[model samples]
Target: MNRLGVQLGSLPWLVLVTGLCITGLWSHQQRSYRQLEHERVERDLAGAISQALTSRLQSTIGVLDAVVGLFDASSAVTRAEFHEFYMALNRRGDTLKGIQGIGYAAVVPNNNVEAFQQQVRASGQPDFTVKPAGTRALTTAILFLQPNDWRNQRALGFDMYSEITRRDAMQLAASTGEPTLSGPVRLLQENSIRPQVGALIYQAIYGQPDRAFNSGQDRRNRLRGWAYSPLRMDDLINGALATINNPALIGTSVLVYDSDRTKPNNLLFDNLNLAGSNKLTHPTWLDVTIANRTWVIGIQLDHRSLNPQGWSNALLLQALLGASLSVLASVITRQLISNHQAVRLALSKEQEVSKERALAGTVFDSSPLAIVVTDPNGVIVQVNQAFCQLTGYSELEAQGNKTNLLRSGRHDSNFYEQMWAAILNKGYWTGEIWNRHRNGQIIRHELSITAVLDPQKNVSNFVGLLRDVSERYAQQEQMRFLATHDQLTGLANRTLLIEELTRSLALARRQRHGVGLLFLDLNNFKPVNDRYGHSTGDALLTAVGQRLLSSVRESDTLCRQGGDEFVLLVPDAPELKQLVAMAHKLVQLLEQPFNELANGAGSIQVSASIGVARWPDHAHDADSLIEAADTAMYQAKHQGGDAIATASSNATL
Candidate 1:
């Protein structure tokens, strides 16, 4: 074989080509990592801005809680009393930082509007009336506003219940008995020349504020009024960014849109217009829910936010790294023998890894057992072909769905909790579970679940292997049936007969009730089997079993105790007369001709000789009971058959 060092060192074109390929690969990897880092930075920036907004809204809402508590402390809050409380709350630093003002609106009914207006006028203000002067069934007028400056004074006595946006928030607050946020609206404090968009959070105050009402209807019925705080969007957004987690969002434009992010009319705030950005900003949006109102907060970050050293430095570094790698490869090519061996070894290892990966994929797809892979959260991420066949869901349908899609409703939540507990604790759980098929059939599965862990020993994914055990389970059930029943006649065999008799005897003894046993043997049956073959004889026994079954009560146990011999057990029997009556009924039933089984065999005839015995009278235990009944059967056989005889048959029935 020729050495690659002898071949490549003699060729300069080969050296240059190798260097170019190496540089291209290095550049591609650097670019890929750069893109990944950019996406990570975008997510981090979005999260930081969302946190700042939420922190400010939550902090401001807390101030309204103190105001609502004032009503809980006093059944009636006078205007002077509300003023004093607001002053005291404001002294607690930064409590009212972003809030425009704190106010209370009184819920007034139309019938009592005059009385409410007179009461408010008498309290302090003489010129108080519900405005803008339209007759409505209910009106919520701004009654008590704190820091009653010229801006807030315009809202006093204004009926907030008349406006659609404010009324929606007030109604929601009253019904839920919780804080509800309103959509964007022009505040009465702003003028048309430079109006600012504003929103409010309303907390409902019910009649008995401490009591937990049953439903929304109950809350609405007991509603007293609402304590609210209004906010100007520009001041609130900027103040939030300044106070909470500063420097992380510095030089970033914060814009908020109401309900929808795409509509320009819904834009609540744009700090870029205030700060004058020279270039268009790209925004990363996060939907923030404030007391049920949705606000889409978008933070537009500069290119420097994506990478710490900036994109220009990142591209320069990529060029530097690629050039360095190419130069080093050229130097190493001079010692071509060692480098060639190393490259060949790396190629061999990579080929082996690729083959292993392909083999694993083939095994997973070809296995008859259904396989599914899920994330740690139990959401299915991958499913093999067998899984689709079993579940009736395609690969596209199964992906992104939770594992509970195939839940049969047979197992409760506790069953799954224990299954997952075992898997997490011991790394695997194997058991039989019931799952529903796509055709709405319940299928039994022999399920084995394994928790796949990463190098750090944290659970990364869950692998589930399901083997359909439906056919195996059905065969098992058939075997179980054969264990306790006579196959020819479908009657209880000796095993089941003994079990039922033992249980019945124990129950009868406890209740002081009588237990009856009737041992019956077919008479004159040997000639028919000899003449018509065993098939006909077996058919006749089945017919006899059906007749005996019809004559017995539901609580009675009838057993075919091998060949022409049968036993009937009756618990809670009243007396010996009942046993004698039942025996007479069976004797007459078997006496009827089996004309249906004639088959030109000249008609078969049969009769039954029954022997009756009662527990606690003839014998106390099961074995002795059977013996006593057997002896009575011999007596009936000797007495020419076709007659009912008992241990006490000497007496008249």
Candidate 2:
């Protein structure tokens, strides 16, 4: 009996060991599967990003080819002709993706410098003269840059041959007869206020019309000029990233390096937040080939943003359940072996198992994710409390209904057909989807749908898990608005104004309509600010913005051109008299006293000096129109205050 008792006790220990071994192996396999799955997902994401970046670069290079074609078709292209070509193909077209500007650079000899300057001066830019104007055997001077706004204007007349980086790229393109990308460098157009890493792509234009660039000697003898475009590295990278569908990439770190070198000096763009030694997770490096040049792109995943969906939680729950079952089995075996009178106690063990199953059900019902279960026929069978709370539907109302009942109508029938196809083919589908709540409000949710199968491999049920993400989308849109508008006045900022002006000018040119521009400068504003403080000045600016907004037509655009400066663009202003009357009205309105709310019982009177310029009359382009208006505004200021001035008719546009 003693030997039998020892064997009986050893049986329980043996069973416990076997259970532990089985659970441990299963857990290991689960972890390994997750790791492998993660790696595959990472690789797929990397390839998608690489393809996007490559496509943008190729498209940008194609724009350079179009620029080359323009020069090839003409023996000598004027600034206006080049500007028109740029507008037709770039500004008015969709080919210029993230390119700063398409510009023309003419190669002039030392003896021809005076003649070149004279030629440029006659081409509408009276101040057109080459910069870094040292005497050289040959110099490549920027002759024209299209969509000539304040930023592009800074690069006009800049001598590219003066800089070795630009010179090297120009020489390479001339010799190869291909688009050559420059190494990382700071653009001449950038100032201390807005510093950005810049690069240039140059396509060579040969002097001999029919000669091919076969050798270095041939290139040197025939090199006439270069058609190039400047690239802000951040703009190019962001443009590429914008095409990606990965939401996890928003906070991910990206680093681009020149020539496969990862050093700081070779760094072209870095989007990482490296403050306080913040390290990246799962960093990867890839070689991106663009126009025969290799750029090393480093991508780092934000592990915190990674989705822990599907099998992870289920694996954990399974492990916990297996371990509990093993413990319960061991206890029951030991109790039964000890005494025959423990039959009731053994039944209690079964009760405990039932209680554990109930605990799992409780966890499912209490989960944060909105989970809904539907039968094989696509009828809702059950839903968790979270689902009820999120969809504003009671369990009683939701049960027996179809998933289509939650459709927001934002998606069409085709979208649903494609979604069902994917789920049927792959057993699961996850994406950002729109659904409607019972309150009739549309909600954006990150949703995952899984199909469960029975022992016969037939569909048993469909389970959906969702988390609301509408607030996140709204916040992203708000951030975009804040980036382009003034916080104080809620009017468009300089960047937005430039874009609007470009679009409006392009439209006017197409329609053969006139565009009127007005530049307004407030008078006696600094004195009021000096006496009452900046709060009063801010109040005055906001009030002025409101008044200006009310005075303009709904189609017109009013922009805060910084500080006390304001600019207005009026479309289809066929008559200058209308512009003059509008300017006078604005001046009269500003001449009224402003009640300072910041200072109780305080009032300050201010006036505005308005300058007006019209397109196809005072100016030929957006840049020229703005310059004319600015020049006239100074004239108005000189003539005292609260006056209106038109651009000089005698001045060349």
Candidate 3:
């Protein structure tokens, strides 16, 4: 047969083969695309649900924090005081949707139960008596519940420590000094006829003596009471779902279980009223940590809502179109196979190049570091998403502008010159630089610049990348300050004091000015430490330091020279009379007794013996000046404490 006749004879078989290929490809692509769409939808829905749940819990916790603050500010939070606080907070428009009421539970000893009950009865609850009124070593009684209604009134006088569920969570709160959540439990407010599952969140409050809540032991020793709130599970779930009530959540159900052991016995709340819906085909479980306890929230989606209805119809239409085109394609292939082969190949190559360019564009836009591409003349031609985000300038605004628009003036012209020189000589430069944002804020950036070259070894363009390093730089400076400062007193340590003294001496020499130095030693401080404790001694020292600092001139430097010793440097002094007057004022201030409440101890009495020295007169160097001041200080102590003496005018010390 001739060539055209042979092609015509094989046309039917070619159409069958082409139809099979189209069916297979279309089936695979449609399945993959549907799967991706389902995953994206599920991810978005789950994220929304999680955020709502987190916000709901956080709001309730905020109310509990305010209640704790009230207890901290008062010596004893009376029922009337708590009621007033509750009414004020309610009027502030800060309402927790799922919270039943916020309350306080006082930690009472067994011996004090009768007194506590008498006090509660005196506070307007005539019939109030402790529940489970048996003698225990320690008891926690709910003394006050806000809103003062019948539902919340039932919780008052109930000892939460008598029940294992509440007691466990209270102990955890007391130990951790953080809010804690109880497992599934029935609240006292719920009636036997129509009971609701509930939980409690508790936070411990300590007295003033407990300054360091460092560990569980410390918390246990110092805990005075608990501030807590009650939660109804159904109300909590409803509040969480209120914001996300849409088609995606229709017919869906949610269940929360305690501690990941999801069973009927452990169920905290269940929104699904139907039995069969509990056995979901695809269920997602997310774990949330609230108040130091884990809660597993199960999201069972409605499978019927996810049906691929329109996609199925579209796939059928696509198959019909594919089969019809197969026959047309077979006929066209036989007539133009040789003539159009090169053209089709060329078109395929062009499509592949376009795809490559698109992939590169996606990567460029998605990069985390700020990226800018400039023409050979350093004018910005292109910018990425991160660059726009960093500088607060859109791509349209930044395209025609040079990078010099970001100069903060913190770097001089020579700095830019050096940067460009490095880029030109080595083809790359990397360092820290200051840049200005569009909002007029100066920011620190770790920047890198590279010279892009053409194939002929000629410069074509430049690429720059920047990352914000402002926070890191601030942290470094903070660390440096801490290293040179005393942690206890926040005064200059030995390292910094020596540096300042050296600088001061050098300046005084050039100006031909006199420097006066004084050495101060606290008297009778050891007796205070021995009678009270080191804490009391430390407080006394702190008080004396503050007094000295306030009494001195702004130019003077008062350095804590280790244990109970202090040195004051007075520069630009022309005579000794001013230094003597300052020494007497400081001694008199130190003579005053510190209050017990303010110092956290009994009243303390202390005095200071001060010695004075003149630079280049009694001493030429820092060490000689210090030695002269020390000898004079001992002379003052010998005469009597709280006296000031100057360096001898003798030949030597």
User: How does each model score on TM-score?
Assistant: 0.47, 0.62, 0.47
| Candidate 1 lDDT score at position 552 | 90
The clash count of every prediction, one per candidate, is 0, 0, 0
lDDT of candidate 1 over 1-653, digit per residue (tens): 36865676655446656777877776667667766665566667677767777888887678878888889888899999998787566544346655668999988854477888999999998888888886787877899887765457668898888889999998888877678889888887665444688888899887887788888778777777899988888767755655445344545666788898667778898866632345544556788888878888776565654542234554665565556545544544544434568885676566556755875786688777899999999999999999999888899999999999899999999999999999999999999999998789999999999999999999999999998878767855664566678767999976677788789889988889988989898987766766776567778889999989998999999998666888998977769987898888888889999888888647788998888999978988876777677667767877776877887653323
Residue-wise lDDT of candidate 2 within 1-653, one digit each (tens)? Answer: 99998999898788788887899789888877776665565666667777987787677788778877887787878777876676566434346645677787888754488888898788788888888877887777888786565557668888888898888888778778888888888997665544779999888887765765567887777777888888888767766766677765666677778884546677887766441244744556778777657788766655544422324666777787777777767866777777675674867578677867887687779787999999977899999999999999999999999988999999988888988899899999999999999999999999999999999988899999999999778856764676567766999876677787788889999998888999999988777766776666677789999988988889888998766889998877768878888888898888777664435656778898888999878987776788788778878887886878888542221
Residue pairs in candidate 3 whose N, alpha carbon or C atoms collide under 3 angstroms: none
Q: In candidate 1, list every pair of residues with a backbone clash.
A: none
Candidate 2 matches the true fold with a TM-score of 0.62
- Taking the tens digit of each residue's C-alpha lDDT, what string does model 3 give over 1-653? 58887876687568768776977688668867865665555556666776787787788788888888887788877778888787566534336444568898888854488897887788787888888889887787888887664457668888999899999999988887788999888998765434778999898888874377667777776788898988888767665665674556655667678885446667877766532453654556777787798887666565544533224534655665566556545644554444477875675466556655875686578777899999988899999999999999999999998999999999888898999999999999999999999999999999999999999988899999999989767855664565566544777755566677778898999999988888888888767766775566666677777878888889888888656878888877667777777788888988887774144555678899988888877888876777788778867877776888889642111
Candidate lDDT scores, in order, read: 0.78, 0.78, 0.76
TM-score of the candidate numbered 1? 0.47
Candidate 2: segments with Cα more than 4 A from true spot: 1-8, 90-93, 110-112, 275-278, 307-318, 332-349, 354-471, 478-653
Q: Which window of 10 residues has the lowest lDDT sum in candidate 1?
A: 305-314
Error of 2 at 447 (Å): 10
Q: What is the C-alpha RMSD of each candidate to the true structure, in Å?
A: 33.6, 10.7, 18.7
Model 1: runs farther than 4 Å from truth? 1-11, 192-194, 211-215, 244-248, 273-282, 304-313, 324-653
